[model samples]
Target: MQYYKKDKDKLVCLLCSYYCKLKTNQIGICGVNKNTGDKIECLVYGHISALNIDPIEKKPLYHFLPKSKSLSLGTVGCNFKCPFCQNYGISQEKNIDKSKYYSPKDIVNIALQYNCDSISYTYNEPTIFYPYAKDIAIEAKKHGIKNVYVSNGFESKEVIDDMVGIIDAVNIDLKCFNDKYYKKELGGNLNQVLENLKHFKKNGIWLEITTLIVPTKNDTYEELEKIAKFIKDELDIYTPWHLSSFHPDYKDLDLPRTSLETLKMAKKIGEDNGLKYVYIGNVPYENSTFCPNCNEVIIKRNRFEVLQNSIKNQHCPKCLYKIQGVYPKMKTIRKTGFAGSFYPQEKEEILKYIDEFNKQITINGSFDTRAMIVPHAGYVYSGFTANIAYNICKDKKPKRVIVIGPSHSMYYEGASIALYDEYETPFGNINIDKEYSNNLKDKYNFLSFDDNMHLEHSTETQAPFIKHYFANTQIVEIVYGKMPFEDLSSLIDEVLEDKENLLLISTDLSHFYTQEEANKLDNICLNAIEKKDMSLFDNGCEACGKLGVKALIYSAIKKDMKTKVLHYCTSFNKTKDASKVVGYTSALIGY
Candidate 1:
């Protein structure tokens, strides 16, 4: 009960829910608030824990102007102790013994010099470092740089009330809606976080939310729907809800990685609930916003690099749709693709895989896959199938490639593009012209370059082959999971018309069926794809990305292209097991 005030002899610790009243020399639940000599001065007011220049999207903001650079600042100390704390290393660390200290004056100068539009208080709870954040925010405001706060959103109404004038935008990470999960797992209350979100919105601060979709923990469809519906109803459909992919890090190691499928489901839940802007982060996707009305691609992106932007004066060029965010000048493809596979991940080992895969594909020719159909699963299983597909398409050195795939790895909206300017594939750097991607988003409603797709392997797996063949080219990436076939075809046919635009479909066939049954099931979808018959294909086709396949089929037919299957095999053929098997296929689509 460390609680003390400056007035006479009374003291109160209002740092957390467990408010402890004290006389002198007592502490509160978070252990930082102390009763000291009848005066309550924040002990770690000037202590900054972490700082960096991060993309605004990394904060999981969709509407706060994409690609805006943020000056991120964080300080140690948090009010709650959650079990699945991603930043536990710093949040629970009492490492005041180490690290250099900087004053508020120093921070103001540094933030100004960094050319940041705003200062984001992130990484750890800014509420615990309230005094310092507030001080820096005040100073930053004088320089015309606004303040942005990224928090767990569990602070009191009073704490949120104080941030009113200073914080221009806030990214609130809502852990859960259930009180049991809040109390047992997060060591907080649900009502508190919800109240703060409404408070930020009511107070007229730009608000965003991020929810890490962890495996077997908070990834229920019901929970996702609830969260999405609440945001749509209370915060308005335009409030961007970032569904981030979760890895087994910190203390949550037993949990498997969040499947891209789960992330897709979450996005669907958001859209189903009428959320206008939804995105997936920490996983790769082609999030180029398209006009929800017209299938015209408003924004063209490959990872972080923006390629083709048709958004003019915030209105769609094709459908006259009003756009959002800062629309920068269009970017050109510098060099794209060149992704390698294999990894326990030493840079050298990863590079070697690319080299080997390239060598195998290069024996054929140089027109390699401008776009490819590769497997996203680990190389040991589907490497040969994915490799052969690349080999067949290695003749065309198209400059821009669009790798489309079903999201088995993370949740995302319409399609998400990785924000990385260049993706590496041992072969070389393939520029993902970020400016062009942003322009694409400006022109479309459903498209955006979300950070979530950067490390997504499905599209990345195809890069090595494209790089091995093209070797020195720039490319773009497009990632999507669920949508109508017509929408996919409409978008692809529009952007990928140039022969230089290589289009790839990375998908595995059937999953978890016996080898024989899988082959039988996958062939049905494959036939439909080859015949360019979208209507014949059913959702039960069970192919990971049948939608993308069917969309490609329609696009190919529209162009009168032929479908060439370079390789088709089951997981059983690639492995010793024949029982529980998946399927793989690599096809060269051509005119």
Candidate 2:
């Protein structure tokens, strides 16, 4: 709210360099923020116009999380009115009341659910939505997720200061070196953008520069060299310069498309000016990342899809020269975050619990099941219920097992798909079905990656059981929060289409209730599952993972699979405290 200043009867917005002064009920030049006589309110705070999961390279971010996915979102309106803006359709359109509202948490959850490495504020100038972007950035930082700004580089110094830690990386547009053109043609200040570029670099935000080379406009050698030299002298030589081609669009429909030769010329100018990495965008040919010192291809790319990255430990494989950008580890392993407490630390202790549970519970016959519902609580509490399913399904021996559960420790909207090479358990390491997981993620917009969400005990507790029962089989863990059961059910149905894939849905019922109350509530869930009656869930079945349970039920009903409850118990069985108890259960769904 302090981003604005009260001047007499008018308020001056300091979010951008324009410094727009507005009367009561007046909006700023961006058309998205309004001065409501008290404070400047972002009209598009929760309104999202465009949202998608795109490759990091499409942000044109060649050096950051290369080959990884990013959750790209933007609202309508912009500070600049460039005629040649390729996305001008949305950027220039200011009436955004019809745009759907997504709270900051929802956006972050979507990013995590999609397995995106970062969240990019793009398609329009992010500075216009500073309040919205700042909120989302704060939430994203909490989960160790990175934030990116695709800006025109004209943010006010105060906003840039706020972005120092929140914004991890940026790709700013240095449209041209001509201040007259910036002011007249683009309705922006070249000096302001240039100053903000230096500010972003000095502030430690990973910086990259892009220039859309409009034919006969900013494609001249002299201007290109000036822009390149400015980057070399002011910014570090390692800063990447992207020379993007301009196509006729929107107001500039009569203008010709930029030739590849002009982009190559700009790239050459950047290199000649001591820039180490210069890429050509909007071209069909491959643009590769090379070692600055050794001049060897460090990362190979076919447009946006990275084919190969040879940087190892942030160094060039050829010369061991230090690289200048963020690099993801070649291999990722999700280690046991809840093993010692949630289950057991030692392999023997875990096996002992399994052995004891097997001895204690006896089911009549083994069933060939495609899906099962298990409780995710400490072994002393719910191991007996969970063991029943693993003991029965071990004979099915599906090639891959997918574990879906609710996020108990965090609030996220969509499902998080674990994208690790391996999942660690007390029994041993379980190989993750990377290929299959990636295929699912690539196919669905709701499925994503969140490293922190995978640490939930609901998903982690099931890993050891899977390893002890189905050794050497691959697994995928999906942790979801605030998601629609219908969507998850569709995904479950798709997985069940494959005869060899087993789905494990984790949940615990009626927490911290009296034993009698717990039993009554737990019975509703049990009856619903036994009858495959999803309608009964609304009648007060208080399963913490009710969404996952509902999804499994929906899938089971659609596949016409029969449901059977193997066991049900309350915490009173172990704690001997009937006053307050938690409920647990195990069930199976198959022919």
Candidate 3:
């Protein structure tokens, strides 16, 4: 609300660090604010350029409302000129022809209607529209909605003073530690931004910092260390630092995307500097929060989605150590498992059934196995066959398991990856390996997240067996609806190259056929799998996961891995129903 005194005919604006003085009918450096007649006016007032319901985690505010959703809105125009602006279309543009106007009261009502716990001024610099944001935030507070600012951290002392009471949280972009890059490249002052960061923290705002680690720019170890140490020293050790990856965008099209290795190194530097909460952004699976006391995983996240939260009453469940964040009143625990149906929900009964299945199968000698193809039918029907494969590969003890199966209930292209933190079974929870799963999604454009695909029994049925055998290993489940075999093969090859990954293809042979006919069809599939032949699918091998099986064979053959058939049976073996039966088979692939 502060404007400079009129000197002669020019009125000076002091809202941001630029402090541009304007004449009559002349706009400030930020195109949205102007001097008309006697006063400075925000030209884009009440004009909303972008609005959406987004997870607070996407703002990279891990320590503030960890898993809640916020009604986010942003107006056009920014004071600074960062070359690698991800939202440059809206942030860098000065035009306002396409923006829609929403009053402060109307914006708060929309946030309430969407069940948002907070209102975020994001996508563009909120400082330029401070008056508008202040009005909306004041209105929002009446309805018990918090206010958040996702800014570039170049606001002046007057702006921070105005935001003291209205703003509840903020994510400031601390771009780089180098003052030269801040002034010459980004057209902003680094020291001013750093001083403003301390001001926000001092004003009782829940502050978090984000630094986009652009390759060959601000990604060096020395620069990252300096930034990390500054956060730990100026801000509290509890303040969260989010290191985001930079992609080629806007004027920085020639720069390469930030590598995973670089992001990991930056995270380590922040941690080494004694910052309690450090996270990697723009990269999946690396955004989880851990307790500083016990180092236990407290909140698990996948991109913008919260997979699971183990923190209860803002304390670690394992150590009862207090965590820093604004948490919801009620804690949510995800209950996973095929309870009361697929397998017995009763602990005693499920353990007994697994023990019986183990007795029925004979364990082969230990071998260096890399992958396996197993059936996913009822435990009574396919348990013995599946057991044989797990028993053969139990010695390999791969650190991560990838389960690929056909999606029976939903139809979608490519493959779907489950975003759950853990897949629960009667045996135990199977932790989803987020790092590898996210890396796969990054490498292959075909991989994505779909809740419906994860509901199918094909992939879910394999979890209990994996939990019982590979208890320490993490799992990644992929359900494909109608992906091409060649694309599937390429995806499999990518997983196989990682020596610690154990791939499991889930499929039951020939559904609903006579015992004799099922045998003939199952044998065709068995021979094809052993021979690594992709042509067998053309001959009508009736396996539900024929595409996945073909992909395994194609990749296995190329890697010179050997395949072995462990066991083969049918539902007839359990029910004695010879007229109608489904075939079951198990095999192991190894180098």
Candidate 4:
């Protein structure tokens, strides 16, 4: 209804450069847009075919929000018919009506629920679904979340005008420089893409360019240099140009995969043409960002993972040279998603329980209190067990506390690090050690930002206890899923090397079992933790946070830290329900 006009007896689509003229019931070049006797109908308006949470680097956007997570979205349609399209299954699919619908509000909520820094319209030509994308972008901007467009540079001037403030960043594919080659091979005009690239820059949108070097098609020296020079002259020299390799897919099966040498050559040409940040993708290369002035490695990356980023305050530490492009803003607050359900939602009530529990516990003599294993359940059921560890460690206060737990809701590989500035709790707000969290993420490849996994009660249940005891110390949360013991243990050992840091591992043992049976299963866990024997855990030592607990045990053994069981109980102790009881325990690991 927005970008269409009635021309005589046909409808003209003004959303793209083609300005497609269609009769009644005729579809545009993009298969999803059709003229239905009255107006242009977007067939895939609410239909989303693919939704994924990916690193910002996976968008091949090196300069935008480095080390942040983006919610990627794709629909089933395209404006071009490139034979060598990497995502042709979705881009070229004809039956797009089968996908489920998610409203614009649904998408915005999903992005927020996952703690995404941005929403990326990727994997296909986003112009084909501009109506859906525009609505989502408008909603996303209201929440301080940015929008990205990974396009083929065919959006009409009218669409660009409409998206001037809504779209924040774009990674447009410049394909090639030759007009004849573009028309014959990609069904697009090269000049149109060139003009749109200039328009995006003129409109103040953060711009990056990509060129999938398809073997002999766009890998020649002449074409690569021309494309590189245009970026320097038309767009600014600071615009990042990504030279990616192409593989044989869909109808382009005869061509060989783009060679590493060709990609390197393109990178050299871009550098020679005065481009500041030229990166090679789809290959094994040191795709790191260097300071243009001093040539120091400011940001080190391994493929999609950032290994180390030394850009302090968005400037190079060595020379204080200011880097270009968008960086992450660490001001998010982890909302209390499970406050009233898992724990108290009022500060007064939480403090009353804390005071009552403190009156019943005393610190054992000279226990160093380096780390703890505490139960995560409602305060009424396991508060005494969990309170024992917190009470013991209250005097030996550390500068920071790292809370590790298992994710019970979402399933994802590796671990999710909470990058928020503050974590919410009924006791009060605790400042998250964002600098330390970023350092760990930079040091390891397995840690990433996946905010949706943080909503689990496994970690949220510990926030109130942390805020109550460690009132001044900062907090860092790590929620793991499908991670190996060695990986997590290695991280634990690293954290313990700093004597001023406290580690809190949250877990609950043996669910919904009879009290008699739970004691047998829970004792095994208690013994294994006390003895620092990982072998005993495999013999039915059940725990919802087994991975975190096991990693702590392994780290304690490696560090020669002794474990002491402070308190142990079952839900039956409070509810008198022996038939279906849950086990809870608390322990301290120290010298």
Tens-place lDDT per residue, model 4, 1-591, is 387999999999988999999999999998989999999988989898889999999888999989889999999988888998879999998688654789999999899889898999999899888999999998887566799999999999999888888899999999998898888878779999999999999999999999999877878899899999899998889999999889889899999989888888999999999999999998889899999999999999999999999888788999999999888665689888887776778888888888888898777586887889999899888888898888878776677899999888888899998988889887778878887899999998999998798887877888888877778688889999997989999999999999989999999999999999999999999999988889988988999988898999998988899999889999998999899999999999989
Tens digits of per-residue lDDT for model 1, 488-511: 778777666666677778788888
Q: Please give, for residues 69-128, the per-residue lDDT of candidate 2 as tens digits.
A: 989999999989999888887899878865467999999889878878799999999999
Instruction: TM-score each candidate.
Output: 0.51, 0.63, 0.55, 0.60
Off by over 4 Å in 3: 3-8, 329-591
Superior by TM-score: candidate 2 or candidate 3: 2
lDDT of 2: 0.89
Q: Each prediction's Cα lDDT score?
A: 0.70, 0.89, 0.85, 0.89
Badly placed stretches (over 4 Å) of model 2 are: 329-423, 426-591
**Model 1 segments more than 4 A misplaced:** 1-10, 14-23, 290-591
**Candidate 4: global Cα-lDDT?**
0.89
Assess the local accuracy of residue 276 in candidate 2 as a C-alpha lDDT between 0 and 100: 93
* lDDT accuracy of residue 489 in candidate 3: 91
* Candidate 2 colliding pairs: 113-448, 114-448, 115-448, 115-449
Whose TM-score is greatest here?
A: 2
